[model samples]
Target chain A: MILTVTPNPALDLTYRVPRLLPGETHRAAAPAVRAGGKGLNVARVLAQTGSAAFILTTAGGAPGLRLADDLEASQLPSELVPVAAPTRSSVAVFDESSGETTVINETGGPLTPAEWTALHDAVDRLVVPATCVVGSGSLPPDAPDDVYARLAAAADAHGLPSVIDAVGAPLVRAAEAGASVVKPNRRELAETTGLDDPVAGARVLLDAGAGLVLVSLGAEGMLAVPPEGEPVHARLGTPLTGNATGAGDAAVAAVASLLAAGVSDPSALVRRATAWSAAAVLAPLAGELAPGFRDVESRIETG
Target chain B: MILTVTPNPALDLTYRVPRLLPGETHRAAAPAVRAGGKGLNVARVLAQTGSAAFILTTAGGAPGLRLADDLEASQLPSELVPVAAPTRSSVAVFDESSGETTVINETGGPLTPAEWTALHDAVDRLVVPATCVVGSGSLPPDAPDDVYARLAAAADAHGLPSVIDAVGAPLVRAAEAGASVVKPNRRELAETTGLDDPVAGARVLLDAGAGLVLVSLGAEGMLAVPPEGEPVHARLGTPLTGNATGAGDAAVAAVASLLAAGVSDPSALVRRATAWSAAAVLAPLAGELAPGFRDVESRIETG
Candidate 1:
């Protein structure tokens, strides 16, 4: 079974407003709440794709309990490590008129030393029989910067394939820890590699010891670089425009699922991952690939 | 003892961002949560003003629990009537560059029949010994629109004064129930009376059997009209400009506090209420009148 870790999970709230006027009160047409974090998104996509995965995360206070309840309501399996402070909440206001989305992400709760130990214990317990482990999203305040790197190292020691989807220093540390795969968007990849050309940045991540590198280019699709194989590319034929919040996480899930299913070909994995990312963009809800996404997967062209 | 009822309270959340870009992710600088509703605001202001009022409201589910925790943390005395569904949460995004505030209010949870019964029982218990009761804010979904009217009637039956702070049909209903005082903003007074002029609107509400009428005009201060006394005019020399989210509620608390203290003069009440309202606007925190706001009350002009 796949184990997904989201250190800084949140209660994701979406408000649908006709138009957002600054310094004005808006009554939302409909409001929705979901359990959200990058690893949780990956776990959700994997579950939807008929894969067995367990979402592991830390949650606290009433908001954290509500987040767990929301996941339960969605029929998603999860195990929560308890903490003292409440989990953070992220707000997304969607304007129907402009199709614009404004996101306000709360900085997640600070993890105490005991809470960190509890999470480490939970992860250790889950890693024993896990075929793959995915570490995603930002670390909470007070958490060590190299926490993801340590988790990746533990996965490597256990012979479990590890996929890292994060940004900035966390991404760099995850790569150095020999993450089986690293998925970073163009902007994050630029920050990581300090390179303007995304293709060159992908090469840098590959050279940094990532067994495989997947760089997502919004609207342009994805680029893939494998350790021992020639690079293959898949670009979107149609502009799949929608909320791209969880597209990268979905791509990580796709790649992990393909690799765990024994698909070793780099080009085939890239083709599948890009199609899943595009499908996620087209879907109304975050982390969900479209119903007929598999049928459209073969239609994607390689560059 | 004073009783303050908030039928539709909210978990008020504020997210501070350096800049808010539509259709993009923005990291929050800080996030804060507080109990919100017109009646709760009144209770908070009353507490700050050295009046110990019992806050009576529905509390259930995650948001409601969080609001209750916040009130407790603030050391405000409260008696929560439990409900099945969670209270609503309102999001305010502050953009520093534009000095713009974007508010997204969630639709409030409707109280079940049992919850309504519990609220009614709490009101019955509080009305017998309470000097004054304040019924404030909008009715939650599935709640009777005349709920405030019923509460006002209960107060009247027990020889207790009820200050109604609501708008539109609810204000009309409370007035019809002979509320001791009704505070409606200029727009709400116009909507309720079909008259744009505050004097005319105040006359209409007095004719509708309201014992006293206080019309709040943002920046222009307040206009008070009593059943038998001359109109009391108390206007702010300097317009209190801020978010203006809970200014009216602060005004209601001032009126309630004065009425409970046996101050029946409309001129003095309006002066104190307007000063408190202005102070609330000046303060950054909702429901809190600034320090030395009582000193400002003495400076208010009453003609």
Candidate 2:
């Protein structure tokens, strides 16, 4: 089974407004709430793809309980580590007119040292039989920036492959800790490698101990760079456009699924991963690979 | 003891941002949560003013529980009637640069007939030896528009003075039920009475069997029109500039306090009420009267 960790999870509240006036009152035409975090998104996508994935997250207070309740209502399997402070909430205001999304992210609750240890313990318990472990999203307050690195190292020690989807110092640390795979978007790749070109940045991550590197270029498609293999290009078979909020998570899930299924070819993994990411954009909510996504997946071009 | 009833209360969440850009993600610099509703605001102000007001509200689900917890944390007295769904949450996004507030209000949980009967029973229980009973805000779903009117009639039957702060058809029904006092802002008064002039609107409400009519004219102060006494005008002697979100509720609290204190003159009541409303703008949060707000009471100019 795949184990997904979302250290800083949230109850994401989305408001739909016709227009957002700076200082004027705008009523939300519709509102929606979802349990959100990068790892949660990955797990959700895995579930949609008919994979057995368990979500481990830290949730607290009423919002946290509500988040857990929502996951249960959605029939998503999850185990929550309770905390004292309320889980942070992220507000996503969607403008249907321009299809632009503005996100207001809350700095999530701080974790106690014991809570962090509890998380490590949970990871230790899951790693014994897990084929793969996925760590995602930002580090909450009181957590070291290298927390993901420690988790990746633990996965490595347990002989389990790890997928790291994060940015900045954490991404650097995860690479140094020998993450099996690292997925970074174009902008993140630029920041991580200080390279103007994403292909060059993917090469840097590959050189930095990541066994495999996947670079997402939004509508342009994806590039896969392996430590010893030639880089492969994957493109969506058709032009599809929609919300891209959780596309990266979908890519990570696809890579994990392919790895777990014993697909060792980087070209085949990149082809499948890019198709999944594109399918996620077509789905309204994050993590769900669109229906007939496989049909679309079969048509993706791997060059 | 003042009995405050909030037919539709909310858990108000305020997000402060430098500016709000439509279709773009904006992070909140600061976020705060508070228990909110017009009657809840009145109860909070009354509590701060050393009045032991008993809040009668339908508090249920997670948000309702949070609101009750907040009230308890504040040491405010309250009696809650449980409902089926969670209370609504209102989002107020304040842009500091433009000093503009955008409100996204959610329709609160609908009360079942059983819940409405339960609330009525609770009101009946309070009818014995009541001083002042206040019903405020919009009617919740599944509840009749005449809910406030019925509550007012119930309070009158028990020789309790009823103060109603609502708008449109609810205010008209509340006044027709012979509310002792009905407070309507200029815009609400115009909407209710079909009169553009607030003074004329006040007279219309008074003619509808309201014992006293209080029309709040933002910045200009308040107008008090009683059944037998001549109309009294109270202008702001001191220029006050602040958020007017809960100013009307603060004014209601002031009127209740003066009535409890046995202030018989409409002119004196209007002066104290307007001053308190002005003081509300100075306070950062709703339901909090500014320190030394009582001092402004004497500055009110009555003509």
Candidate 3:
């Protein structure tokens, strides 16, 4: 079983509007809501692919209650550490006319120290039965930047490999903490490492003691850099044109699944991650893989 | 005591964004939430004025739970009728840079027949101690258009006056049911009665057996049309502007308060409603009048 941690989770609401106009009033039908966060998306994909996954997160207030209820209805196994602040919501307004979506995200929290401690305690309790540990998404403003690093350290003590999918200081901290694998898309890598070239940006993490760095290049696929060896690059022959919101999380799911099963080959990780991500893009919503994902692996060209 | 019915109550969420750009993603802090619907807004104003007001509305699902919690926290008297469908939300994203707001309203409910019957039952059980009945806002999509009319008829049966603040078919039905007062803003009147002239449209409601018609003309103030007397016009000496969203509801609140006290004089109703509506415009949010509302009435010119 893989254990995933989402420091900040959201109740994602999607509304379909006839058109979207700034500074105007719009009336829409009831929205489609889901329990969402980067780690939860990864866990959802893992579960769909027949892997046992458990989720650890914090929620509070009405939106949190709603998220808990949705998780229960979805049959996803999760432990919600209650907090005083309400869970935030991410609203996506899809314009039917132009097929464009406008998103509004509420910056979740400045979790109290006690709330953070409760979350850490939950992770400690749940991590024992997991084969691999994964931590993803943004931290609350007041949360310690070394949150994922602490998770990596905990996983190391447990003799388990860890995957960290995050950005900014947390991503850098995860690398420095010697996480088994760190995943960041091209933009995130560039921003965090201050390097425009994807390979150069990934090397910074590898230099910081990360065992592996997977840089997602969106339609172009992915690049895997090892501490010692030539980087392996892989991608599908035809790029998919669909919702790309969950592609990165899907990549994390693939890497975590392979690592949990004791697959460590750089080329294999890159190939599977690329195929799964492409499959995710073909699906209509996040946290879902297209039906023919198995065939996508054959189409990946690795070097 | 005033009984207010909001067929479709909402959890109103207000977010302050740095700027609002179409087809772009924005991150904002947590939203301010309140129990909001037209009738609830009316009740809030009445409560603030030291009047006893009771709320009757249908709520379900998580948002409903939140609304119920908010009403409880507000210390307002209310009875929430449960239904299968979830209550909807109205989100307002205010752009701090431009000082403009974008509103997204989720059209709530097509309440089941059983749910509608339950709502009617709640009103029947709670209307006994009410001095006046106030039915406000849009009915749910599947609800009978004569919902407010039914409330008026119910009030008549109880020897109480009814104030219907609605638009379209519901507004027309309220008038035909001989509601003591029917209030609609200029735009609502034009759309419902198909007349550009406010007085002419108001006259239509009075001719439909309405005892009185109050037409809110926004910054121009209000016009009162009594069934057997010349229409009275009232306005502040100088127009004060802040937020006009709650102006009409404030006007309805004023009329309800006056009628509850058995003040049936058209000129008095026009003067008070006009002053309160102006005071609401000067207030920053809906369901609140500016601090100097007493002075506002003294400044009103009724002719």
Candidate 4:
């Protein structure tokens, strides 16, 4: 079973508007609301692929209750760590005319020190039985910046493979803990490492103790640098042009699920992860993978 | 006690952003969520004036739960008639640099027929002991178009003076039900009555059986026409340049609270209502009147 942790999850509300003109009164169609976060998205994709996945998230107030209710109603499995602050809502306005999507994110999770510890304890308990653990998304304000690093450290101590799908200090700390893999998108890797060269940035992360580094290159697909093997580049023949918000999450799911299934080859994992990321773009929702993922996976090449 | 009903109330989420650029990702500031609708706005304003006003509205799902919780936290009085559908959320993006407010209304209240009848019955029960009844806002889809008319008809039969703040078919029907007063903004009045002149449109409503009609003219203030008295126009000395979303609701609140206090004179009612409407714009939030209402009232004209 793969366990995913999202410290700052959101109740996502996506509304489809005809034109989406800014500074105007728009009448949005019925919104599609769901539980959304990087870890939650990863768990959802993992579950859809027939992999057992459990989501560990923090939720509070009414939006949190709604997120919990949605998780129950969905095919994904989850456990919530309750808190006092209301979970945040992310609004996405899809403009039909221009084929554009506008996103407004409300960052939340004002967790007390006790609440943060509760998450740590829950994760500690779940990691023992978990085949692999994944920590994703931004840490809420005031949360110790090294929380993800600590999770990676704990997973390492337990002899469990771990994946960290985050950026900034958390990403650096996770790498320092020597997690099985650390996946950062092109921009995040560059921003956190403050390096112009992507390969150099990945090397920097490897030096910090990561066993493997997967840098998502967007349209160019993915790059994999393993400790004992040659660097590999994987890409689909044709680039997908759809919502890219959850593509990285899908990649994280693929990496975690592949590792949990005992696929130790970094090349095989990157090929599968890149295909799944493309599938996420084809799907309409953020936490969903398209049905054609297997076909897409067959077309991806790693060299 | 003044009784107010909002058949399709909302959980309002307002976010402040430095500037809103369409089709872009925005990191919004902390949002302000509240229970808001025409009737609830009226009830809140009445509460501020030391009048006992009870809000009767249908609430369901998570947003409804949040709205109920917010109402409980506020000073206003309310009772939520439970339903199965979640209440809708209307998001307002306030641009700080430009001082522009963009509103996105998610039209909802897909209330089942059983839910509609439940609201009707609840309103019937509450109106019995009420000093005056007020029904406001647009009815949700699937609800009978004559819902407000029916409420007005019930108020008439119970000999309860009532105010209806609505537009279009609902507004016309409410007028036909002989509601004690019907307030429609100038645009709504002209659109419903198909008259270019707001005064002529108001006259048409009075002819349709509304004992009085108050037409809001934005900066020009308000216009009142009674069944037996000549039409009177009231205006504050200056126009307010703040949020005017709830100005009309404040007018309804002033009218209802005054009627409950046994002030039946239409001219007197319109003067105070205009002042309160101006005060509402001066204040930052809906359901609140600025303390300068008395000063604004002293400068208002009824001629």
True contacts kept of each: 0.84, 0.60, 0.91, 0.81
What tens-digit string does per-residue lDDT give for candidate 1 at B1-303?
A: 789998888888888887878888887744778888788888888888888788998877777778888989988888888888878888888888877778888768888888888898899998887899899887887777688888899999988888998888888888999999999999988888889998888888788889899989888888899887688889777655675778898899999998899886888789989999889888877788888797888778878
> What would the per-residue lDDT of candidate 2 be over residues B213-303, giving only the tens digit for each residue?
9999988999998887588999887687778878999999988877766664788879888988988998988898999888988888999
Q: What are the models' TM-scores?
A: 0.92, 0.89, 0.88, 0.88
lDDT of 3 by residue, A1-303 (tens): 899999999999999989987777798888898998899999999999989999999898888988998999989899999988888899988889987778898889779988888888888888889899999998887789889998998888898999999998999999999899999999999999999999899899988879999999888899999988899999888757887889999999999999999998999999999999999998888899999988999999988
Give RMSD (Å) of candidate 4 vs. truth.
3.2
lDDT string, candidate 4, A126-241, tens digits: 99889999999977777787889988988888889999998898899999988899999999999999997778899999999998999999999999988766889999998679
Name the DockQ score for candidate 2: 0.43
Off by over 4 Å in 2: A15-31, A94-101, A190-204, A228-240, A295-303, B26-31, B127-129, B226-233, B237-240, B295-303
How many clashes (backbone N, Cα, C below 3 Å) per candidate?
Answer: 0, 3, 0, 0
Give the total clashing residue pairs for model 1.
0
Chain A vs native chain A, TM-score per candidate: 0.95, 0.94, 0.98, 0.97
List candidate 1 segments past 4 Å from native.
A113-125, A158-160, A227-231, B227-233, B298-303
How far off is residue B176 in model 2, in Å?
Answer: 1.1
lDDT of 1 by residue, A76-95 (tens): 77889998888888888888
Per-residue lDDT value at A231 in model 3: 91
* Candidate 2 lDDT score at position B89: 83
What is the docking quality class of candidate 3?
medium
DockQ of every candidate: 0.62, 0.43, 0.67, 0.60
Considering only chain B, report the TM-score of each candidate against the true chain B.
Answer: 0.95, 0.95, 0.97, 0.97
Residue runs of model 3 more than 4 Å from their true location after superposition: A59-62, A81-85, A109-129, A194-198, A219-221, A229-240, A297-303, B49-52, B59-61, B82-85, B110-129, B194-200, B218-223, B226-241, B265-268, B297-303
Angstrom error at residue B98, model 2: 3.9
Overall local distance difference test of candidate 4: 0.88
